[model samples]
Target: MTVKAEPFDLSGKVAMVTGAAGGLGQCFAKTLSAAGASVVLCSRDRDRPELVRLANDLAGAERLAMDVVSHASVEQAFEVLDEKGIQVDILVNNAGVAISGRAQALSDADWNAVVDTNLRGAWTVSQQLAKRLIEQSRPGSIVNIASILGLQPSKGTAPYAVSKAGLIQMTRALALEWARFNIRVNALSPGYIETDINREFLQSDTAAAHIKRIPTRRVGVAEDLAGPILLLASAAGEHMTGSNLVVDGGHSCASL
Candidate 1:
């Protein structure tokens, strides 16, 4: 007998994941697809081989070339979706960059790149989606991929941590303002997840010492955040908004 996925099922929903070419972004796209949502894998380059391959592996998936930092690019991406008659109800703002450096040493361009992509970019995407949802009187969910560093301090991650902190606050502020429209906004902050973005750092001596501060005594894998991602994306978390779900293996609570 065919069984229904009662709790985390996302059938009949459409999820768009940004930065789908990256490690955690890829994981989010795959996870949403596995839960029955028709996924749209987005990257700066739609024709990227990795993104194209990912789209081919999923059912009813589409590829979008979107640079979240550019308002024109974001607007164009949505326009393309509208042309295709695809209405996305689930959005994963997972496009982010980390430039490792101290605050004093980082260049203005580097700082702007990180902040523009992580904070302003997220705002643009959320606002775009919320406007359409409100127009159609439809409900939707937005999941922002944040980090433990947003809640605390991390060396050599000044820009990334600050950007994530802004995103977390943005999640709450948007949730409060958009709840009346039935739009739920939340953040998922992961701790030291092993991905291409930070695999080398997580495996390095500095990270090794830092890992001991986590109660779990180990770094997390992308799979570790799947449940939290689904909870914020699906009906299972209908009543949840303005919430930041930190999936950091107790790293946030740990003391030096």
Candidate 2:
């Protein structure tokens, strides 16, 4: 008799992903769901039709309306899970916003918006997951979507860069504090993904010039992130935590 061995499959696992309506979020959701995990797509635009299509395509995937900046909203969102007896085995804090401007020209509102969503949002969602995982005696994984900007500064993106830097530190702190609960936390800092966010900019000569600096000589696609996202969320990365994985095509390394 042969005993069947399991691989990195996430069957029976439940995943909650923030920012599920966007390109990156949709990629992660589709990848994880394809790998056999029940995915919960959370975003402020839960009513959007695109989300409905995503939910239908991915087995066991669903959508929830969530605003990460509001603590009261977070609590209320979690209450639904509590009622359903759903415990998340994986959490991806993939929601973020970017604001670009010279340091002096950046408006206070823009700065606040970037920080509140990129940094505070990740922290708040992680807190919500940590509390539930600890109380329910569940072991889980958390992958926070940071940026290469977090590791180094990019010109004219002070607010966006600063928030990502903060997220890396927050992921480290959470990993240390929650290790006892068997919860792993880490960050993925992707570089120059060709998504809705930068499509127009990349089409211009100036933007194309900057993109050519990458060793790959091409911008990343949304699907380029799917494999890395799954590796961190599934059993394949069970031993890794508090580490920031940089997926930039060497753009951050070039001097010129």
Candidate 3:
């Protein structure tokens, strides 16, 4: 009898993580590398030092410049990957932006920026990955990094929330349409993971009061999302397409 490899093991696989220069994207790339997948770190600038350092530190890792908000940039990046003969087996659509503003006060610029980066950008990237996978007749996984605010509305985050909500819906729709091709698409919605961009706010008095609203009584850290990402990226979640894995420390549950 032969022993099967662990379902979570990603040995010999390739994972492309967008927005991988820093924050949660960094953690996701590192985690996938640890699970034995060759990671492709993609960001607005491929030459970013942190991305280069990470690629150097990890085995079988490469860094690429890809701006999710720019279709031409995304296309060019994929063309380069094709030239390099790198077929991504797992795609993490983790590139997103959040602009805080009430619906009434939000400028068109603010709304468009958030919506374009968070929703339209994710769709563009996912579509590119899925198209390549289908053309190659390869099965793959796609993990969309979403937010609890997508499920539970919050004040002063209208544009961000709407974008994430659209993202969750996009994940479901893509999963439904691509299941026939054996491609899994899912959303991993985080509650409030602390990242460099939000560090100041997380330490502020306003955040202190807000923390109590969560059942866990604390906002999560970037490391908190490692498990959910792995589950979705590997064979462990092969049967979980179209599902939304909430990693919000029960925050979304309270609203439900």
Candidate 4:
């Protein structure tokens, strides 16, 4: 006999999405909210008009200021959540920065900046959230937004690749350590996605050449990640901790 599958429902869940002011972060917040979770749209600057507008527009959505690079900032954000009696049941660590430059010419500042935000930042936020879940004896989920570059190297993306690779490993380590507490940790590695910042470049001839290398022969959009993200964030993925789900339109399958 086959058992009925659980629904991918997040009703009554509270999800915190970092860097939700724009881009993929905003999309993540919107997706989670639509699935019935009360979303906390977090950005380094919560006072941005767009963020405020989004928070007000989405039912059961709120905005908070959080800088994942700073432990103090992460702590303060959680403290505010505590004051409001909001416990985080899901976390989307999507705040990241990419500094493209030749590895030989990369400055200490640039390398540090990328690593700090991409790796350290995720750690800071995840640690704080894990602590809260442990204290309350509740189960939770964490989805780290990684990249295809993490699995393979590319030109002028050394630091970014390194950071993402580290994050992937960190996901496994955290999942192993936190399993007893019922906190699942996983990584979501997305391929090249056309966003406001990269749209022009991605549409250029130079990008066209790169696109040919992809098996799918097309770049992904932010919405392409919605299903994978929601699966990892909800009960449907309860047994999926320590996995790195790659949604890159077959970019990683091509022979380099």
Candidate 5:
């Protein structure tokens, strides 16, 4: 008798990525799709033409309107998935917002918005998806997009920093609790990536000066993180759980 060896083929795996209209989330969705996972591209607004177009191009991908901060929206989106017969094998909690200001100057709205979207949103999505995975008795993976600010911090972005720190701890706690069910939870912390949300900052002289401090001496591109994103979403990271994979050009080590 001969034994055939199978490889890291995610042929039947399904992935749900929040914030799919943004650069980082879009990269995750496309990368998972390229690796053979049927992907669910989700955003708060269902009318994003670019996201819809890209999802259509991905052959096995679909789109959903998910407001992670709203339990009703999240429930409706998952119900859509169920109706479509989609079983999510991976969930990427990448929906986030950044509000940068001195803590003393920050308004209630600014603080609430950041905390609601970045921290609570990830928790809601993870809890909902984990429940589904547990019910099905299926193994799953979850990757939450955190930030280096979670480990270190800057003075102005208190809410964003605190939210990310909470996200990292959430990943660890969830991983510990869900390990028995074969559901792995982890965080991907990217440092100084050039994306639409930060385009103006990236082009500013201050951002340029900051990039020079990095050991890599350059800013990170969206595609640079795509490979790591794919690895975690696929069987390549099957044994990895509760880890924070920092893909930041070594900036966390360099001091001002």
Candidate 6:
């Protein structure tokens, strides 16, 4: 007897991705759209022509203005979606910032900015989505974008590391709590991926030295994360929750 494999189809599902203007968020938006999900690409400023162009290129794509750092902005975005009857079945909490400073020199504002956007903003979005899903009696999936630094800290990234660590814990807590509702929450932790934002840094001597230590001996690209993101966002991972999938090119293992 032969058995058929489960389909990873996300057809007819609606996906909302925060920070979809560029970088990993852009890659994520494209990936989700290619998988047949109606994607809502969100950014702080939706007026950017590039965003509009990207949205036009993807099937069932729409752009929206959303600032995860502000509660009002989050609520407004959701309201717009509600008005349009766009129910979000999958959420990619990919909006985050990194502030580089020595631990002792890190200002309160810098710390708060990173924490508020990465940790607090994620919570705000997740809470809102959870409420809506529960009210509608629907099962949903949430994939939090975390970092390898969250598991193993490095120098000059105190604020970023702390925020991502908190996010990892948040993923587990929400996953455990929301499982009762058939809602799945998981974290996707990526290592140093070469994106437009970090390309210059990755070319520097400091980054080169770091790359040599990795078992893969190469840096990752934005597209490298696409498949993993799709897996967690689609039915392929229905039985998975409270799990942290680390795609770090074995960098974390090098320490051992």
Error of 5 at 144 (Å): 0.3
**Lowest summed lDDT window (length 10), candidate 3:** 247-256
Task: Please provide, for model 6 over 89-206, each residue's C-alpha lDDT reduced to its tens digit, 9 standing for 90 to 100.
Answer: 9999999988886899989999999999999999999999999999999999999999998898888888998999999999999999999998999999999998765777788888
Give candidate 2's TM-score. Answer: 0.95
Off by over 4 Å in 5: 1-7
- Write down the lDDT of every candidate, Cα atoms only: 0.91, 0.88, 0.90, 0.91, 0.88, 0.91
Give per-residue CA lDDT, model 4, range 169-231, as digits (tens).
999999999999999999999989987646777877867888999998889989999999999
> Candidates' TM-scores?
0.96, 0.95, 0.96, 0.96, 0.95, 0.96
RMSD list, candidates in order: 2.7, 2.2, 1.7, 1.5, 2.2, 1.6
Worst 10-residue lDDT window for candidate 6 reads 1-10
Candidate 3, residues 77-164: lDDT per residue as tens digits? 9999999999999999998877886689889999989899899999998889889999999999999998988997777889988999
lDDT of 2 by residue, 1-256 (tens): 6533654698999999998988899999988888989999998878888788999888878788889988888788888888887888999999898888789999999999999999998988899889989998999999999999898887788998899999999999999999999999999999988777777767888777788788888788888888888889988887899999988878888742
lDDT by residue (tens digit), candidate 1, 102-181:
78999999999999999999999988899999999999999998888888867788989999999999999999999999
Better of 1 and 2 by lDDT: 1
In candidate 4, which residue pairs clash? none
Error of 2 at 219 (Å): 0.3
lDDT of 5 by residue, 202-226 (tens): 7887778889999999888989888
Cα displacement (Å) at residue 56, model 3: 1.4
Q: Report the Cα lDDT for residue 5, model 2.
A: 60
Candidate 4, TM-score vs. the true structure?
0.96
lDDT of 3 at 217: 86
Q: What lDDT score is found at residue 228 in candidate 6?
A: 94
